[model samples]
Target chain A: MRFTILFSISLLLTGSRGFAQQRFVLEQSSISFHSDGVIEDIAATNTNVSSIFDASKGEIAYLLNMKDFQFPKKLMQVHFNEKYVESEKYPRASFEGKIVGFDPAVEGLQQVNAVGRMTIHGVTKDVQFPGTVERKGGMLAMKANFILKLQDYAIKVPQIVWQNIAQQVEVTVDFNYRAQ
Target chain B: MMRRILPFVFLLPLLAHAQGDLLDELNKTKPGTDYTIATFKGTRLVNGHTIETKQAGTLEFIFAHRFGPLDGGVYEMFGLDEAFVRLGLDYGITDNLSVSIGRNSADKIMDSYVKYKALSQRSGQKSFPFTLTALGGVAYSISPRRDDEPEGFETVDRLAYTGQLLLARKFSPRLSLQLMPTFIHKNAVSKTVERNDHVALGVGGRLKLTRSVALTTEYYYRLDPPDNDVLEAQTLSPRYNSLGFGIDIETGGHVFQLVLTNTTSLTERTFITQTQGDFFDGKIHLGFNVTRTFQLKKQERR
Candidate 1:
């Protein structure tokens, strides 16, 4: 009877340990967006990103500072943060989602789906996109490409420069995470 | 023994699920700092200065024009027939420091100034209620000295200096206000004036009417009015405080301003102490200014 209790306690401890060890922290990440306007092309990239992945529960989260995005033109950068994003009022954009088929024990690259809520410019909306998760050398790398509608987030573009901005924007995220 | 082990096994996955609240953990690590932006679109608020400054490594080109008094009627084509132009360039040496140079056609005066931001309004760890900036400038008249001036006038007599302390606050996303305490000193005055030093207080505000448009107004009150006796004896016209009202429109890389003002001079030294036109008498000139910015620094690839 004593041996049975000891064996169960050991199993419980190992189970909790395995779950805790599955948490991963992002080592490097990049987020970029592109929009094709009638009069011009708008593009920006933000490399300062923070994110976490939990393979044990198929959970992931990402946070990006809006002011950190770099544009080819300084004035455009100012307009993006001031007029479009209103970064002062809404400083950060974030996402919280679950990987459809994430497994810590799985090896190699696996295509998966992510479904969650994305918050930007003080507005939140449901989003779903296809992604890939690669597990190699005891680390996980995630890459995703998606499209977002500016109107959905309540980002208003005035009629004066209507042709200078696009209705839809393409966003791509790449993150490589290591065990916490 | 089986009962105890069964309960522990059931709680294991629940505990693992709770551990997946990674977002909460990330939130805790994020620095709590928020800095306000776009307090005002440009550095100038009509005829007065604001606390706004250019970002590091940026260059701005400005073209300003003011026409004759609108009261001139159709003969003057509603003030469009005669134009006084000021062309300027400003460069940001650092995020908080900038330098500008301009030449005004009204007096054929060359102007240069250096501006430094002393404090910025923000919340969280570093919180301040208002922004503060220091501005100092000099204007040198390129026009020949008047023959009516007293003898022994040197070249330095054509120089004037200006200093101002600007305080501003972004009260809301749509409203911003500023106060300017200004001082101007002229090396030589027209013999009638008793003193060359002039002090003034200026107030300015901006109200956003739309996402890309704002209504701006400013007024400067002279504290030390020129000697009335000297003014009436030697001057044909009387001087009044400067007043301006305008609208600002912003595009991607450009800002355009349309204004009406009683002052034809573009620099602080001339406008603060030498405004002879009065708005109440319909002596206001129609004006507009265009500003374009360029990024001079190359961004590093990460």
Candidate 2:
């Protein structure tokens, strides 16, 4: 009888561990801008996501080939190589942040903060964003929302499009990381 | 008399022969030698040019897909939507030269022309990093016309030509713009009045509104008096040539265009026609074009 009880407990522990391991990736991740009078939006998306951990201290990151963050159609794709992001010169945009007050034991759901440095268009800024850390089954899901201002990142929104584009752009980041 | 006359006649024949040979050589060479074939993909469409692309030797399936269906509805009555589909193939005979043949969707008009990259914005990759410029071939429309027209009317049914120049620059990741200067020539004006060919300046651009959607607009201005210059004789007041405005929403292989154009003619030539009641009264056209790219058979490479 004792052997049966111990075996059951061990099985539960293994099941929880599997749920805790999570990995989420966005095939097309982008932040867009829209405003009055003019209808113009810009989206920058490339493979940009990183692994997350609980209990143990680990870093999470998001990367984007700033050069690859294409504009509208082929126009952006062609001139993109030479003009804007200067992909040939400055290859990538990245962010490195670690989860704070993160604990896997508490279970359920809890609000946490991720402190990190985000580099965009070659400029980096320190940011502290609030996110919900979810522990479900054996998976970990992190969802956060933050505002990113173009001027802050030194991304000069052109005057021609000044009226169309907003000075401050809103960004949302959601990641689900599973155990490898 | 015999010797002198013989010598004169022989010389005349020789001169004619020489002239004929020169003419023949000129005919063999494509027109617009000095101009570059300034054809990039039309900014109106997402893919760029309307010309069908060919790879290897066979027709590339992707190229075939570049051209959408041949749609002719009642809109053709007012010449509102009279377009066939044209896929042009350009060949580079030399590094600095290329020639192209394009078929129009309306009337199946075929255009053959040559372009020269006289100068490129990207010279050796470093000269002008921000701006690109090119001067090239003028496009000519060559479609067979009916020999006879109904009685009592003038026929403006002849091949027309246009010289186009393309210039583009990117200000940043979110903004980019292009300018095209086009000169259009027509043999005869509408039956209403007499006028010369039309010269127009076009400005177009693509702004990334979102990752998948873009705000696209183009404006055409006749450097000379608009077609309305002829209209004044009949209407007391002349009306300006049609102005075009459109937006392109692209997702995957599909492109949907919401346009507010005074004229519905898609081709550059047809739109140049001076017609009334074609102007937009807020009644816009919603056009959607979807292109599917596929790999062609190994033997189909062109």
Best by DockQ: 1
lDDT of 2 by residue, A112-178 (tens): 9988887866788898988887776556677778777768866554555334556676676666655
Model 1 pairs in collision: none
lDDT of 1 by residue, A1-180 (tens): 766776677677767675565878889889999998777788889988899887877888988889889887666877888888888789889999898977677899999999998999999999999999999966889999999889999998775665778888999989999987
Shift of residue B163 alpha carbon in model 1, Å: 1.6
Report the Cα interface RMSD of each model, rounded to 1 decimal: 4.0, 33.8
Estimate the lDDT of model 2: 0.47
Contacts from the true interface found in each model, as a fraction, amount to 0.36, 0.00
RMSD of each: 4.3, 26.4
Residue B274 displacement in candidate 2 (angstroms): 4.1
TM-score of 2: 0.43
C-alpha DockQ for predicted model 2: 0.01
